[model samples]
Target: MNFKVVPFKALTPQQLYTIYHLRVTVFVVEQTCAYQEVDDLDLTAEHLLGVDTDGRLMAYARLMQEPNQQARIGRVLVNPADRGHGYGQLLVQTAIEQIQQLWPETTQIKIQAQHYLDQFYQSFGFKPVSSVYLEDDIPHQDMILTL
Candidate 1:
């Protein structure tokens, strides 16, 4: 499971491709979500990618800080075969570190997480801040991790 988590700007073309392919495989094909994955945020985001020993992308997510004083963590995805490997948890921890590095004064990390995974994110210190709502036809809730 040799992996490296690099910022979005530091990602190579191949790395970006591996990420999108994995996202499409899991989010689109597996979850049946037909929405667009590339929402124009990647250009300014700091991506945390988990590449396996063979250079395959096992997991990925992005981090961005908006004007509302909220640092966002989104676009979380893990390859189907890679589930239960703890890569997603590592990706999140790395993303949080990136946010802290970029905005040390920031107090909260926000995420619109899928409803069923609320407890999973909670284990990492995230607290639900919004009533559950549907996003892309899937139930989701807004969660925030306060630093």
Candidate 2:
């Protein structure tokens, strides 16, 4: 899979449409969770799109600088049809690398990860910083990686 890091303003209409589609399909429709998926963050966050050779969006994530002097990665997802391939892994590693490049002085990264993926995030050196809490009725925990 090829990955493209595009800021919100740089994303084309079709790309935006596909991103919203994939995110909704997995986070809402498939998970049966109802909440606001689209938000103000999309306006400032840089987007990571993992696309396949056939030009389909295989995975996606977002990187943004936060007010608390931390870089954040969020809205992470792998396309349902594209799951078993480690695209999520690549997506996250790429997000970290991009954060480093885009904000060199930043030394910490944060994620409000789904609770079930604790081990996965742990593998990347993120440790739980908050107790698991319900967000949109789904369990989530804040994890942080101190770089």
Candidate 3:
């Protein structure tokens, strides 16, 4: 699969549509969660898109620089048809690399990961930093990857 990562403003309209559709497909329609997916974060955060050779959005994530001087990664979503293809890992690693480049002095990366995927995030050096909490009716925990 061909893959590339770009910032939010750099995303083409087609890519934006595909990313939104994929997020709604898995986050709301499939998971039955109804929270607003298009939050204000996208305006300033770095967006990463993982597309296939056929130009399908396989996975996506966002990186944000917080006021507390920490780099954050969130909104991780993998297309249902693309799960188990290691696309999630690739998406996240790409975001982390981009964040590192964007903020070289940043030493920690934070994420509010779904509870069930704790081990998956751990594989990327993210450790549980908070007790599991409910967000948008789903269990989530704050995890951090310290660089």
Candidate 4:
């Protein structure tokens, strides 16, 4: 998979549409979670898009960093059609690298990950900071990866 990190303003209209489409498909419909899919967060976050050779979006996440605050990784998802091919790991690894490069002052990265992915995030050295809790009715755990 090919990876690219783009700021919100740099994303083309079509790419933005595709990103939202996949997020809705996976996070809303596939996961059966109902809540706001598009929020103000998109306006300032750096978006990581992992695409196949054909330019098809395969994975995505939003990266955000603010002064004196830990960077955040959110809205992470692998295209349902493109799962099981390690794109999830690729997408996440790329997101982490991007954060480290773009915000060297950041001391950590935070994620509100689905409960099922707790171990997966742990594999990346993300320690659970909160016990399992419901977010939008889906079990989630807050995790932090210290840089």
TM per candidate: 0.90, 0.96, 0.91, 0.97
Q: What lDDT does model 2 reach?
A: 0.92
lDDT of each: 0.83, 0.92, 0.84, 0.92
Give the per-residue lDDT digits (tens) of candidate 3, residues 10-100: 9889888888888788888988998998889888877777777777777788789986668999788888887887878888878888888
**Stretches of candidate 1 exceeding 4 Å from the true structure:** 2-9
The 10 consecutive residues of candidate 3 with the worst lDDT sum are 1-10
Q: Between prediction 1 and prediction 4, which has the larger lDDT?
A: 4
lDDT of 2 by residue, 56-105 (tens): 99999989998666899999999999889888888899999999998888
Q: What would you estimate as the lDDT of candidate 3?
A: 0.84
**Model 1 TM-score, 2 decimals:** 0.90
Q: Write the per-residue lDDT of candidate 4 for residues 4-100, one digit (tens) a residue.
A: 9999999999999999999999988998989999999999999999988889999999999966758999999999898898888888889999998
Q: Give the TM-score of candidate 4.
A: 0.97
Tell me the lDDT of candidate 4: 0.92
